[model samples]
Target: MSETTQRILPPTEALICFNLYAASHGFIRLYAPYLERIGLTYPQFLVLLTLRGPEGEGQPQGVGELGALLGMESNTLSPLLKRMQGAGLLTRTRSEEDERRVVIALTEAGRARAEAAAEVPGCIAKDTGLSEEDYHTTLEVLRKLRGQIAGLDGKPATE
Candidate 1:
């Protein structure tokens, strides 16, 4: 082989992307049992959490708006929303102001489910073994990294 052809790539363990991928999988595994008990998939759990909001009060949101918040395309979010609605977790209705807009609101059942899942983050945090400060720092770093990566190729990071 030529000298150029003999160049070696970084080992998988040394690659930040690989580490991040593995860490993500680890986190998912940690969340699996809790999510299963709640009868929600990871994506669905994310939707539920987002709709629950930080203040524990969720206002109705437009389909497009919800999709944007979740970083999901409407095509992907629509079927998930439909399934959630079928399970009586939420309601989808056309906006009176704009018939073209479909609004989503958590039903009573959804609120109850959200309440039941309240301890999930705490459980995951305990499993992570990160101190409060370290946890916040890690979150800040990850968010910054994600924003920078997303901003590549002239794409908006905040999206």
Candidate 2:
């Protein structure tokens, strides 16, 4: 067979992107039941988690702020925020200081839900079946990789 026509096994193991993508899907599946019990999808849960501040406070943020934090666009986030608002999980209000800016805040119910969902990280860590050392090591590597990629676009890592 010509080199161009030769068929070889796919190098799935060699592709970091593929591994990361697949792992994310796996984690989503694992998290589905937990999220469903609380009437949330993965992304919705992420939004609630992000809105929560230190000591369970709800930090009011703007749509732009949330989009920037989640790496999402307004077109996508607006509908999601609306859905959450409809569900009484959060509220979006026009800023008093800036009429053009909209601020988002979690409701009391949202705070309780977020607190309830805090156990998810522990569940995920347990599901990974990795030792504490390996888990931290892998997390650090991924964080560094994300930082490097962000830096390529002239944006520093958030931390």
Candidate 3:
């Protein structure tokens, strides 16, 4: 093929997506034991974390709101919420003012579980061996990249 027509693809090791995918798996593996101890899957743990406020208080929220915050669709989040409710980790109640809305709140058990898992982040951070500064910087960069990528979903590929 002519030089202009030749398509050269970078090796997998040199691809950003490949590195991100591998790092995500590694992070999940690091979280596995801690999550298991808290009787949670990673997604379940994320739910608890999102439901918690900065001050460590559980914030009661509508199911739709919770799903949005977690970047989950209702169809996917519903079954997980149901399972959590069954496990006594949370309560799902019809909103008093809006029957169509289901509100989610952490039960005492769920709060306790969240507290128990509080150290998991620290553990995972330490395991990564990244300095505190580097860790925060990396997290910031990843979040920015994720947002930018997500924004491109409906846009033309060339853009």
Among all candidates shown, the one with the greatest TM-score: 3
lDDT of every predicted structure (CA atoms): 0.88, 0.87, 0.88
lDDT of 2 by residue, 43-155 (tens): 89889989986566678999999999888999999999999999999999999999999999999998888887777878888987889999999999998988789777865
How far off is model 1, as Cα RMSD?
5.1
The sequence of per-residue lDDT tens digits that candidate 1 reaches over residues 25-55 is 9999999999999888888888888888987
lDDT of 1: 0.88
Error of 1 at 153 (Å): 4.6
Local accuracy of candidate 3 as per-residue lDDT tens digits, 56-131: 8788999999988888999999999999999999999999999999999999999988887776898888888999
Q: How close is candidate 1 to the true structure, as a TM-score?
A: 0.87
lDDT of 2 at 97: 98
Cα deviation of 89, candidate 3, in Å: 0.2
lDDT against true structure, model 2:
0.87
Error of 2 at 31 (Å): 0.6
- Local lDDT at 140 for model 1: 98
Each candidate's TM vs. the true structure? 0.87, 0.85, 0.89
